[model samples]
Target: MKRILTAIVLIAIVVSLVLLGKLWMITLLAGAIAVLAALEYRTISAAMKSPVPMWWTIGAIALFFLAVFLRPQDTITAVVFSTLVLFAWNALATGVDRVLGETASGVLLLVYIAYPLTLLPQIWSLENGTALLLFLFLCVWCGDIAALYVGKNFGKRKLAPTLSPNKTWEGAIASVVAAVGFGMALIALGNWLSTNGSGYTRLHTSAPWWEYVLLAILLNIAAQFGDLLESALKRGAGVKDSGTLLPGHGGVLDRIDALLLAAPVLWFVWVVKEYFSLGSF
Candidate 1:
């Protein structure tokens, strides 16, 4: 019940943001998510007795998202230097015994949890960015849901028993099929809406069915990898569910682990369109 209610509220919030279709709103949403996810990471680290400078880590993450909004090109440089600062901060703050481990944790969170999230804002600034962002969320959510249902009912072979015991090959297959189906549905809807009126102009896709299918498969694979990576981290830390902030969602990190990888991969495909001949479509 809690999970269902949480899902409903999240869907409403996401729909509202996407409907607003403002770049600033997307940036604000991404920035908030970065901070909340950082908090969840800090909580997990603290539970594992590997606490770092929470303020520095979270601040650097927030700054990275801000950089995405104000200056996209400088994000890499900013993350590099911020990582260095995080290393130095943790080394000096904590004893030498766990400096390397703790420092690595902070840096990893920046890359794994924080950086990829900022891509949503970047995607929002593109042509048809609103549609693209919505497509991303739809495909990911469909894949997640399909994977869970199919895996629970028909799973026989474990995909990664050590990292995530619940996942299975059947579920992975289901996720890919569902993602592709959802992508095609979005494309069809986008085309119809694109032709009908200019008012609904933000959501459009020119890619052919084959290319979109390939994209669906690619994103599902990336999302699954992100999920496994987070699961491994949690297992290593000897904890489950990064935090209890959400009623049934575990934490912001739990909700976004898949997006962390998929968003950047999807964004990369768009910005590098000439090479892939994506813009022609």
Candidate 2:
């Protein structure tokens, strides 16, 4: 019950933000999430004996989101470069014994946690951005729910025993199926709205069905990997949940870990389709 309620509230908030279709608003929300996730990442890194500076990590993450919000084109190159420079300087200031571990963890905090999330607003700024954002959310959310139920009831063969003992191949397969099904349904609804002149112009109603299916598959795979990636991190850090920020969920990081990878995959596809004039997908 608690988990269901939390999921409902999160869905509502995300839908409201996407519907508003404002870049800054979405960036602001993403920024808050990034900060919280970074905080959790800091703790996890510390637990693994690779402690990164909390203030530096938070600052870099903030700058990453801000850069993406203000200048999407060169945000990654600029922010990541500056962040590395800071990490190098810090290494010089402190001792160099744990430099490799600390620096690597800092970089992971930026590239893994901060960079991919900045793509949310970028995805929103694309053509049919609102619909795209909602589609991404729906697919991931449906996959997560399906994986949970399927894994618990029918899971036998472990997917990755070292990283996450509970996950199973059965659950992973079900997640992909559920994500693709929900994605197609959403696309169908968009087609209906477009045909009926429902005033919902944020959807890409003309794309071929197969393209959307392929996208759903790609996103589902990415999301699954994202979940496994977080699980590996937690396992390495010797913790179960990332943090207790979200009741029945874990932490902001635990919740958005999938998006950490899934968002960038969508953004890359959007870029290729738009910038390269692919005209589809």
**Which stretches of candidate 1 lie above 4 Å from their native place?**
47-49, 197-199, 275-281
TM-score of each candidate? 0.93, 0.94
Query: All candidates: CA RMSD in angstroms?
Result: 1.9, 1.7
> Model 1, 199-244: lDDT tens per residue?
5665677667688788888888899998988887789888789877
How does each model score on lDDT? Answer: 0.82, 0.85
> Residue 247 error for model 2, in Å?
0.6
Ten contiguous residues minimizing lDDT sum, candidate 2: 197-206
Q: Write the per-residue lDDT of candidate 2 for residues 75-190, one digit (tens) a residue.
A: 86767676677678667876777888888888888889888888888778766777788889978999988999999999998998888888999999999999999999988888
lDDT of 1: 0.82
Among the numbered candidates, top TM-score falls to 2
RMSD of 1: 1.9
